[model samples]
Target: PVAAASIGQVYKAVLRADASPTGERMTVAVKCQRPNILETVTLDLLTIRGVVDFFCTVPGEGNKKLRQDAQGLLAVLDLAATRFLEELDYLQEAANGARFEREMNAVPVMRDVVKVPSVLLDYSSRYVITQEWVEGVKLTDLEGDPKYANEEGAALRADVVRKLLNAYMVQFLETGFLHADPHPGNFLIQPDGRLCIMDYGMMTEILPDQRLAFVEYMAHLTAGQYSKTLDDLVTLGFVSEELAKDPAKREVVGPVLAQTLSALYAEGGGLDKKVEILDQQAQSRIGEIGDKLEELSKEYPITLPPYFILILRAFGTLEGLGLSTNSDFAILEECFPYIARRLLSDDSPRMRSALRTFIYGGGDRLNVAKVEDLTRGFGSFTNAMEAERKVAVTGEGSLAVRSSATPSGQLDAATKELLELMFAPEGNYVQELIIEEAVRAVDSLSRDALVQVWQRLPGAPPGAL
Candidate 1:
């Protein structure tokens, strides 16, 4: 078998030249659905539903709200089951693969770095899918492979992970179509160093507004703004809007949610260590919070949206892979550049507001330190600015411009792309921010100069200035 999954097993094969679309023999993986999987899955879901229904039928006043919460869970389970059933349809999987390829190619950076196998729709059916064979190993196996044990291999691992993370960000924030199953086995690292994503059976879609809210949510969470993060949670359909609006419920939910996420984003640990920490907390502080939320839900009706479950599963699996690839991996850290790019490029009013909030502190003061940190890792930031400056002054070729005072730097294609976005006509918002800061600084200097001159005047009263 080429591969095995819960509902199917894949077998390797070579299509006959006469039957192949290319008119040449081609290697392929034929995935066949397991016999009786549909009936088995349906029965399993019914069993689970019966158990829940049993609880809902119990006689008690408290069971009333419990029934409501259970119904919500059942609804989500039904949605998930529907998605699982669709996976048995190889035709849909073929379409998903095609769509994924199209969307990834639309992003300039991803076009070359990511690879998706072509689906042979002619030979595919409801039970079997024939796809182009990818010659690669599971992404997690890279760490243990002898070829990747050296410094160069380490760099390769990091680069591939970064690209994969950015691709997922584009899927969630830009395309709104997400490849929901992101377990280690779903990704393969080709010998040529390109990443091949597989198994598009489980997928989800985020609405336009939900994607924007997700971006806003990530921005606020990364900024350590817990209150705003909680607000975004409601917007993204995690917490109930009614509970979020009530100041009393907000008081209870806000701290608990922040504490849970704080453990998730806590410093000094990779994803593995963070999981351990969360497990420990689940027995103590978080364990207690869980009990409190359960009681609170009786009256407030807290709920989880089905899409949130898929998003969590996708990111959680990715974070695990990041941990395996790099010991210092942190999802927020790896996700920052992509998030910043979105904030810089999106022209919506909400995005503009978020950009300002991220770059400016209270009293409308520019956070220069934060801005520098954000752009410091951008390889072409200094090079692009310097090259443009010299070209403007000497009317020379930008590429030929270099300085002995600065180290030699090559242009980074990704940063160069982001620079275009930041300098575009729609990017005047960023320019306005810089101008505001410069004006504020000049005004402050002039006031200080006047005060100094007044204080130094002859016969000036003590502290009069």
Candidate 2:
């Protein structure tokens, strides 16, 4: 079979003539597991558990208590990890794909904005999955392309981001089930400009209560309701009450939380700020806090429900993809509305109590006006596609030669800076820095210089050089 992914392989095949649904020849993409993937997954889980367990037990302030709490917490995590890993089963994947299609069909907006591959359930077997072949280019390839460098391009990119975020929010809050992976490679942009999303081996479902808690947490963050946000986080098991009550412990986490909230409000910022806060520097200082928490968890460790971890991982993947496309894409802004709605519409006693505290305690109100403004912005962005223009396909074997209006403007200064930073002798922090730099360099330098520089960069893909 042809390889399609890191953990699985895909093959292009024709359905048996007699078995054709339409009685016509059809191509299908078949995905199957790579040898030893199960083993690799098992080992990975073990490693994660061991590392988290050991870290929880490390001696430090409150570390002993955290260790005690972590023991039971670890057991719960292990159980969830096992369940998630079991989703790798071909049968489970098929069922999930069917459910996803049903969910997608229920949402009218999703029909236009997102593409869910048509699964060939009858053709699937114990170790294999068959789905319709989707023809398109990966979004990863479009990043920094001159074809997508203009105002229209930026708007299209932004629209796709918004649509994806909206879809996730609705799925998590309304349906409680979601596609857990949003990586670029799993996303395809058709020539006709439709967004095709494939690969559903890792779908997850959230419990209703947990989903409600998550929504409230999101609402609190978006509304700038810090104390409520903290309470919601604790309710969701992302943090513990002890941490919330202890000023010393809170002191350790307080600035990070403030920075995270501030970054959310900053123009052109998003989840990247949270990631930056979690980087090497923060990790070093906060490692002890985490250890202490884990130790404390051994006795009173907060057990995060399975769905919450899945949501966290899903968001993490989405944020990574956003950064990969453009360092400036803000995910939280796209996600705020559904969260706000969840909080405001909630009728549960916990939610009511939280809302009472939020309102009476002078918590910031959900900015309905801001949500309306953002929704308008998103609509404008989507409806504002650039006028159709042709580009010349250069070199021999070129199918056509055409010229349209030359695209205007140079690359942004920040883009240029990022490009230059990639060439630094010291290590660059982000992967693909060198590749991005090469693309920027080509835009800035002479053809010969561009070619020379491109040749020097290792792993410059075919069209890139």
Candidate 3:
């Protein structure tokens, strides 16, 4: 009753069995895949990819981007075709659902935040999967409601988002099996406030070794160790070993990655307009980056390993979800805890290398970005709030109020609440000063205080204290 997608339609039905836990008849979600969906998807991909190939072949102004990424386009379509075809297998989905149920069981603490419906194996077929029906408020509905837009409301949404993301970290970094598709309709807010996850048609399995490398790559990135991140990326196969070994082969990928990811996770940078800006950059920065890529590929390849594509897609999708929830959820920042836990809690050469890659002790410097972010957020809030007040006093809607903002306004709302917490009875602010600036978090508070006030501040992830 809730959803119909390209692949399937879900209907509410009552399943009957003598050994039913609740009764002889129990409500279940019956997901029936469209007949010959695989064929349909194949034909669609063929049509789209064919057109894309045509553009890549005929050199033109609008086709420049496609031409540049032509080979990659073909590879991605090929890879996607395989994955999309797999999504049509109801039996595989049933198994994926079962696996997720097992994962949920392993971490009982996670029950508060997320859940998986019970699958009825006997009722499942190659084209149809049946599982226990779950009733709850859709995640989008919770965010759409006017009441959940304030500081407290944002905090609640942020908590749920964090829990959901952390669970994903465990899946990708620890369990090695992830629900690759987490589009909005796949989630629900249970009556008791837990997140219910449904639809496991698309899942990614990260090989054990690949998972470790991913963790190392993330750790280095989080610590602002760009040089180390480059090495990790090379070792992870994003770059060819030939390039890593050849100094003559110029590569500016490290700086690009560092700047890109840093900007992405920077305060006030989550979701919101950043995504559009980044997409625009991809199209606009071609002249700047295309030459470097071409030169770099001469000595080495720039191929992304098969599994990495799925992982990256999931990451991007997560950002979209963050945008919807109006929460500042940083993917790399969130990865820190899970990666640290693994390295510190385990013993191995890989773990040692990962720990080593995590750099510490940088020269003290003001994070101008963080300050700029605070200023901008403050400005937006002041402007928006002032507009609202003007409307109330003048009895005229001359200016529009941004009360329904997605990320930009919501971030400021959360920041205002945190500033209240950051201040003390002593009448001074506990501003985030130099993040990793070696400021002692001791009795000497103010003189040592560094403002997290900007996006430039870096240290342990928030709440690590």
Candidate 4:
């Protein structure tokens, strides 16, 4: 046996040719469910329900009530219990793995680097799952192992981590089907240099509207609009409308959220600097951020929705990986390009609504600076993707040969898309805003300023201005 957990143990085995999916003898990993795990899980759940019932009905000192808290925790626990029970059925896990493989292959950026092992359904059962054996070290072990601690090793780890992060981004922003168990234990760095994602027992699906709300959440958070950030969270089913609308709770919760989330912006300048300022303000009187959160949970009823919990778990695990690999790694810096690409490229009406909200959420005024940032981010992301495609087509070993130059073809396509959006009937308001902003800029320029601009143009005649 190679690995054992609470519910299962994995063994190395050689499958017979008749049982193999390819009709050839091959080594495989057989994961067998623990004996009588269902009864054990049932007992544990019953005990938990009893405790939950007790707390929900019982009152504490000073007549402190816990019904609201218990109710919220119960909802999350029920969802978790359902997933855990599903894990006992190995066939369900196999189905989850197959679906994940299909989704990962659907993304061009991930198809080459990420993979899911194929399941041998003929050998698999409700109690046993058989999959093709893969040889590699756990991703966590690669960071500090002597064989992978040198310069080359560092480069490989960095590349692998970037690809892994991109895979998670695709799951969150595009696919909506996310692997909730994203810890280091579930990922292996194969000898052939591909990331093997294992253990699909705990997967979650986000509704399309929820995914769009999350995209908007990232946009608002990056812009340092905490109030709108709260609104996005509400739309995401994180915060109850009653709790979010309460003026007193907002006064306390807003700053705490800012402090916790701004930790992602601990690098770079400009917008990052602004985020740092907000963090500093929020941390003025903190005993500890965790303590504050605990106190808030006691003071208010904060529900942990299943999807929201899974999202946080995945992101937190990824952030931990980033920090372990590089002391100076900033999660937001690594994640913003993905968010920007989605914002610019996704043409669904919900996404278009999100983009408009991002631009005008602050007030009636047009946020020209925000629009400029979006375009710049999109261009950089497009250039990087183009470089990656070229490298993949050429069968290059790494990104060392990737070019730093912009790809004009992608930019031209983006420009065309923007033009179509601008002239479309639904975009009339945006068109008016753009023209008004342009005329305002020109009207504000002095004759001397106009002359300077004209003289700076290519092939301008001397004294033409």
Which of the numbered candidates is closest to the native, going by highest TM-score? 1
Residues 96-143 of candidate 1 have per-residue lDDT tens digits of 988998888787556655678989989898889889999887876776
Stretches > 4 Å off in candidate 3 = 17-24, 49-68, 108-113, 248-257, 265-294, 297-301, 325-329, 359-465
* Per-residue lDDT of candidate 3, residues 1-465 (tens digit): 557887788898876666566667898888888777777778898998898777678767776556757767777777777887778888988998999888866753354345699998888999999899887767677678797778776766665565567668778877788888876667876655556888887888888888888777766666677767767777777876666665444346654555566667643345555676556556655436755766666546667777678888887887766655565555665445455445443446776555444423133344455334334433443333333333334544321112424354355433454455346343322232322333554534653354333334565466433
TM per candidate: 0.82, 0.63, 0.67, 0.76
Comparing 2 and 4 on TM-score, the stronger one: 4
Model 4 ranges with Cα > 4 A deviation: 16-19, 60-65, 243-260, 263-300, 357-465
lDDT at 324, model 4: 60
At residue 128, give the lDDT of candidate 2: 86
lDDT per residue as tens, model 4, 4-95: 88899999999788866678989999999989999999899989978886776666565354677676677778888888888888999999
Q: Which regions of candidate 1 are displaced past 4 Å?
A: 16-18, 64-69, 140-159, 268-297, 326-328, 377-409, 414-422, 425-427, 452-465
> Clash pairs of candidate 4?
none
lDDT at 62, model 1:
65
**Ranking of candidates on lDDT, top first:** 1, 4, 3, 2
Please, what are the lDDT tens digits per residue for candidate 2 over residues 175-288? 777877777777776654556777777777877887777666655565556766766778777677877887766655555565555555433444555466556434665555
